[model samples]
Target chain A: MNAIAETVMLDSASTSVTNAVVMDCRIEKIFYGDFLAVRDSRVPIKKNKIIGFIGPSGCGKSTVLRSLNRMNDLIPIFRFEGKVTYHGQDIYDRKVDPVVVRRYIGMVFQQPNPFSMSIFDNVAFGLRLNRFKGDLSERVEQALRGAALWNEVKDKLKNSGLSLSGGQQQRLCIARAIATEPDMLLMDEPCSALDPIATRKVEELMLELKEKYTIAIVTHNMQQAMRVADTTAFFAVDISQGSRTGYLVEMGATRQIFEQPQQQLTREYVRGEFS
Target chain B: MNDSHLSAESILQAVAGDAPRNLQRAPLEIRTLKSGALTALTWVMAVLASIPLFSVIYMLLVEGGSRLDWEALTALPPSAFEAGGGFGNAIIGTLVMVGIATLISVPIGILASVYLAILDPNSKLAQTARFLAKVLTGFPSILAGVFVYATMVVTMKSYSALAGGMALAVLMLPTVILAAEQAMMMVPKKMKDAAFGMGCTRTQVIWNVVLPTGMPGILTGVMLAVAGAAGESAPLLFTALFSNYYLSSLTEPTASLSILIFNFSGMPYDNQIELAWAASLVLVLIVLVLNVVARFVGRQKF
Candidate 1:
């Protein structure tokens, strides 16, 4: 219904998105019921880059990431003021469907939650949901190949997606997200459940995926953000009033955020000195 | 004997004692004795609870077993002055009416439950639907019969199998909806969230994730409802009335196992009494099979 937003979305599809903002969350506030979960300032996710959000336990890294795709809208109490635009179209706009927003912005959860369906079906799920007109098996293979899991799971594509190892299941989830051809991917602590070797594999996959799609990741592991993120946003909890609230402390090139963080909180967090 | 994640040294320091062996593994302590006494009491009470059920089964076997023959299952019932016969027509009619009830109830119950439990659970309308469904579960079967009698039977101007089924469907709908709502609710939020994240609409999530995962439990509820419907005579009394002949049309009078038993048990003739006993055996056997089937269905076979 917003004519300007619709035209911008259409125009962006044809134009080069180099240095362009694919998704932006310039929110004034994020609320879950009455609690101020995130006192949001501007946190724009740029095109074709992995932006890793890192913070303490209560800090709203995942909240910001979820808001990017309007995934927070699924939570009954989740309410936000201000724009979360995908391709310059305000996703929270009354007419902009969250279902459509999600199709363009995929998410991989903290846990490797493969549907109870088979591996091939799991990858094909999104495409099927969108009624994809392509050769489904080929797209599933391509996505699986893209996630660097094709060789391991290609032979047993018919098996339950849950039948794979934890690492492979995570990769299968990656394949599933990409098969829908989303312009971006959001991962929430994707490697927390994995071993060091598996974590390394996922980290590698993220760097590879950044070439084709924008990525926003929330991670507890600072070293992981250092490894994979092009830009890193450090969030910190403000506990001055007894009730805690998370806010973006600093967002810069990953190196600067790690080596020369502008904020004292960022410095303390990266140095593992949380008081 | 051995240690894994928590080494023996850590375990010794953590427990400061003999571990699981130290943790109340006494053979004859007073607390242990009390637990054993309670366990014995539980088993006794369980057996006590089973007594009535087993006794009824025993009574059916002793009183009804003799007349449960091939002819009693496949042949038409005898006339009032006749000697020996079967209630095959009754069996057919019962199956047909229950089939209709199931057809009516299953979809409506499942869809309405999805609305109540999944879509708008906290809404006032959903709350009212839930409350009404619970109330209906406790509703008297005779009341259901009366409702159908006014709405269906009087309008149709004939005691028909369709009317009987409508009455049974009313009785069944509440049970199916409640059980199914609970079943759908029990599907993990994680699974649904995954579906939603994959760009599925709410309807898609319910159809693709919620229903499949909740299916075994839903089937159990359905089978229970079916068993309950099959055993009701009061609902069929005014709605279906009775038919001694084979059910030719769904719009005509029908005979059910419950009604046959109800009718023949009060008859003066010995043959009719024997036929009633045989019918009771059949009905009990049907309910027993349904319970067994429900168990198998309830298990996560997938």
Candidate 2:
């Protein structure tokens, strides 16, 4: 094992008794009907830390992030040959229900997909779906505050969720995800469509959210990884005889990955030499 | 002459002065003539298409206007050779039978469409069902009447409102299914993704998100089906036959506006012919009101 893997394994072992590893991906290969999409990937996600997955387009970072919550199961042709575990239990086990798994691990997509519903209803969607017993208004308020969207939307709670600006819609989606109080959150290029100011706001929200919930984000923006991520995993594409496959190249502390990458590909990627 | 040295305003003034004092407009090119001809042809085609509908309405209004009154709206029809009666019972019967048909067809049609668009889309069974539905839309209304005549009327041993309603329901099923399926298909796929990502089960996603978003469209389809069912006379002729009294039960013979219009228009009596014209006008008005209400309801926010 390399030094980064060794360090991650040590951390995993040290925190095993406490079950601090929120998710562990031991993905050997992912296939879309016999076409390889990702291969030979192993990543350990710790609790209450923001981990960034950075790579060029078509490197399978989003695919890998989606698999953590079993969102890829929706695709008819998608099949993966490895295990993804949540809190020491293999989520791919036959008895494990994906709906239940998703309840504990929420996701924010690339586009700001707010439902065609009232603002309050959007924030309260997951809570209502999971049959939350607490005061619904209070829980919605708490979630909105958690996402730093409370003040902006407090007066327009009854307005359509689609009526908000794109940035506010994304924040409402964040509020909706966190309202379920999931143990971990997965974000797939959450800020790619936002303006710079909105992107900064979302990045700041991610930093604040990491103090409570574990986060794994896929981003094409290297600077975004540098700013918000505590640890960064760099994925690279491998092309041989026309078929391109993606695999994890290196992962370590953000400073180490950006300032002193251990692998040649990582060095080249961070130096902007080549993707 | 020194165009390069002149400012833009001076050049514009000079060119304007040098331009022809009485400039003639350009003649129409062959392309413009062809396009204008095509536009006029389309307008003519549109008017020709509407001629039958407008003429029918105009004939109904002109011939029936003199006889239409409160008495005609509230009284039963007179005997073939006699006069001084109305088609009130037929109006009530039409409403009741169409209401029954709506209740029967809307649920089954909407459910089948849900299955086609959401549950098993692209499956061989779904494709076959959709193909058969499209074929059924083109199936003759007289064949629908014959179907009810064979199955329900023969089994019941009598012409009754129930049999008539069943026939109309059969005629309406394909339209409701096709329209509702289209509306359900238009529900954005991203909405489903968002729902699933929030930990909702498939059933919940369909019930809470899909159905509500598609409800207005489905309702509009249902209204259209109801209007179409109201205008069908062949099925009612085979099943309900005719009754001069108001509908008392589903198993009883019932009178409807279209059947009244059909039976009366062929008679030699002038009074019955006038009554037929009024009934035709009332039927057209009913259909017009239904379509207008559908548009109004469809415009409401879901």
Candidate 3:
């Protein structure tokens, strides 16, 4: 009777675990040294949803994005009170490894930080770091293809990543991030430094990627958020005692947030009535 | 009244036209003062630095001319002042000592530089080690020689080639450490960060990206250390103990050009004095050659 009960429990546990939420961050506060940066945030990230965080400058939208992958942990003085979970497991648990968390959630920085290495090597970097000893060339090609940069740089794999134009470098960075086959991607104003054409390319790429992986993007461009994000959250800046804090004003389906914002401030900001 | 207003309008337009052109002119006094001061300072600094260098070279070439014969190049160091001889043994011994010293110092210096440059800049141990390296760099050369003498020579009961080489190594270490560190520091941080972002471990980033990028600087540093090691006499004086004969084994004492210079400079004989000058000239020329070689190797347009 005990053996039969154990088998039944195992079957149910495995099925629920398969449908687990990818990321959940409940952050009460983010402090840099003694100054608060962001506050009172709770976000549940479902698989393959493109979530957008949009706000004005100094709003801590990027701060919240970085915290999801523990990228802000690199700063020596960065401190936060938060519970960030990945795949139903607490990511900040004492026994958890940061490297493993990063492996699952790749990030593209605002500036195009392509490796000084060749374009091919830049794409291959993440895969090699994870010790994926498969056909490196094929994987690099696939990543480049996914980023929509293969046609421009396919013939010049040996060329330096820095040799590319600004838009190309950004695409190369995207390719590098995706090369590791991460389950989720974080982009911090990825298209802000790009031209209109490049911005459209990146937007389209984000839309395409939502079919495979969950994505969270922090953007100041409200139009961009409207175009690509399925779910949209507005971050509002509040400062006290020279310390800045950002709180989420409202979050809902993108169409509803833009068309029928419930918050008066969100409506004003979205309608260009207030900065 | 209408005619007067039209006249005033034409006059105002003429003044406005000239105003922009007049405003474009540079202030003459400021430009003249800057050029004059720059010229005066350049000449003053150039002349001040050239005087000492000119005098030393003039003295070496004039006093040492007669003694720098082919015989001096071939003959061995004489045990007595009456017997005229050359610095062949000293030259060969100097070469051997410097070679061994280079062998010991270069690897350690380059590795330490790699650690300082490519490793965790945030690590407390690395920071403390850098501070210690700086302190060691300020330690006196004579002190280094004495330390080596007390440790290697006195304890071993004799000054061997090994002890001399060790003293030279000690003298070269600080220079090598500082130079190598600076060279490594010149490598751009972007390169290292890019390598890290790719998933390369700390060691891989250093070996593959950082070291190669900083290679030219490392070469220049090692060469500077080698050039410095060539003229060092104080550290080797008590440590290596000087020999008038050729050296073949690590256990035997070795004579170097600096020792030869010290001994010959004190002799009353005119030939010995000339020999000292000739030896000095040769050592300077060797140093010049090494620096030229280093510069040649390190020169990169980019």
- Model 1: runs farther than 4 Å from truth? A1-18, A151-156, A163-165, A240-243, B1-28, B58-66, B288-301
Alpha-carbon runs more than 4 Å astray in model 3: A1-20, A150-159, A195-201, A208-212, A240-242, A273-275, B1-30, B43-135, B176-220, B244-247, B261-302
- What is the iRMS for every candidate structure? 1.6, 1.4, 3.8
**In every candidate, what fraction of the native interface contacts is reproduced?**
0.57, 0.55, 0.11
* Candidate 2 docking class: medium
Q: Among all windows of ten consecutive residues in candidate 1 chain A, which has the lowest summed lDDT?
A: A1-10
List the pairs of residues colliding in candidate 3: none
DockQ of each: 0.55, 0.50, 0.17
CA shift at A231, candidate 2, in angstroms? 1.7
Model 1 Cα shift for residue B168 (angstroms): 0.9
> lDDT tens digits, residues A165-273, model 3?
9898999988988887777889989998999999999999999988767899998899999999988999888875566688888888999999999998799889977
Interface RMSD of candidate 3, in Å, is 3.8
For model 1 the local lDDT of residue A87 reads 68
**lDDT for each residue of candidate 3 in B1-302, tens digit (9 for 90 to 100):** 99998888788778885323354646477987898889999999999999998887788888876778877877987655466689988888888888889888888877776677655655787788778877986777788789988998889989887888888887677678777777778767655544544445567777766665666777777787788888888888878878877787777888899888998899888878889999998888778888898778766422
TM-score of 1: 0.88
How many angstroms is residue A27 displaced in model 1 relative to the true structure, after the best TM-score fit?
Answer: 1.9
